[model samples]
Target: MTEDQVLDEFRAAEALLEGHFILSSGLRSPRYLQCARVLMDPRRAARLTDALAATLPAELKIDAVVSPAMGGVIAGHEMGRSLGVPAMFLERPTGTFELRRGFRLEPGTRVLMMEDVVTTGLSSREAMKAIAAAGGTVVAAAALVDRSNGKAEFDVPFYPLIRLDVPSYAADALPPELAAIPAVKPGSRAIA
Candidate 1:
């Protein structure tokens, strides 16, 4: 799907939120993409993931798909379905990503790490690091929304359905406009 189309879906689903919100990455933004809401409809989810899967190069073989849990589970599962691969999730059992609950990869297994939204790409990079530590190769990373605005970097190639340049601010350096508004933590992860 085109960026505009994806954005339209977000709007139609009421997933594109506007408020003084704290992201999972600990940054504050006036806008947020609540992908769980967007991906709630199976048909819309399938269509988006299918389009996301189509972006992968034909030569790249994805052995398995792994995603960071809670936020990414459903979206990654749908993407895995489109790619016809096993889908698994990484949990933070000890405050960091891990292949817990018997979910794993064989040595040299090609993995496609996915997420619902990527702000600073921290979660994706953490999951990739864990996957690498467990003997898997993260071939690439994909996400439903990239709120990083094209600035976040990852160890693997990053592919996002929509590249949204949302403005964010650090707590100590909030913009005057954003500072005046009350901040709400709407993301799944809690700030430290």
Candidate 2:
């Protein structure tokens, strides 16, 4: 799908939006892309998954789709279905993402790590580590929206369906509109 088309769909789904948001990157932003809004629509979610699936090379065989839990679950499932692979999700346990609920990656399993949104790529990194520790080989990383604009660090090749170059503000760098808003740190691990 064209970039404009994808963005249009995002807007249509009211997923990409603006507000006081604490991104998963520990950065404060006035805008937030609530990906669940888009993923909630099966057809729209499939369209995005199809687009993301196109980026994978035919030679790179993916055994399963693994994503960090909460937001990435549905997207990962859809992507896995599109690629004809099994889907798994990692949930946080004691400040770290681990394969819980009897989920195990067989040795030498080729895994693709996915996220609903990529800001600092923290969750994706943790998911990669867990997969690696479980003896799974991470082939690539994918997300529905990559707000990092390619600045985020990752060992594997990162792929995002929609790259939004939206501006972000730190606690002190917040805009006047957000000046009165309560501060919330952004990071993959949200300490409730």
Top candidate when judged by TM-score against the true structure = 1
Q: Residue 44 in candidate 1 has what lDDT?
A: 91
State TM-scores per candidate: 0.96, 0.91
Quantify all predictions' global Cα lDDT against the true fold.
Answer: 0.89, 0.84
For residues 1-192, what per-residue lDDT tens digits would candidate 2 score against the true structure? 888998888899987666677876667787787788888999999999999999888777999999988889999999998899999998877777788898899999999898888887777888899889888999899998898867778888888887888777766787798877766543335644
- After TM-score superposition, the amount by which residue 13's alpha carbon in candidate 1 deviates from its true location, in angstroms, is 1.2
Checking candidate 1 for backbone clashes, the offending pairs are none
Candidate 2 vs. true structure, TM-score: 0.91
Q: Report the poorest 10 consecutive residues by lDDT, candidate 2.
A: 183-192
Candidate 1 residue 37 Cα shift, in angstroms, is 0.4
Q: Candidate 1: where is the Cα deviation over 4 Å?
A: none
Candidate 2 backbone collisions, by pair: 24-187, 26-186
Question: Could you give candidate 1's per-residue lDDT for residues 85-165 as a string of tens digits?
Answer: 999989997899898888879999999999999899888888899889888999999998888878889877888887888
* Cα lDDT over the full model 2: 0.84
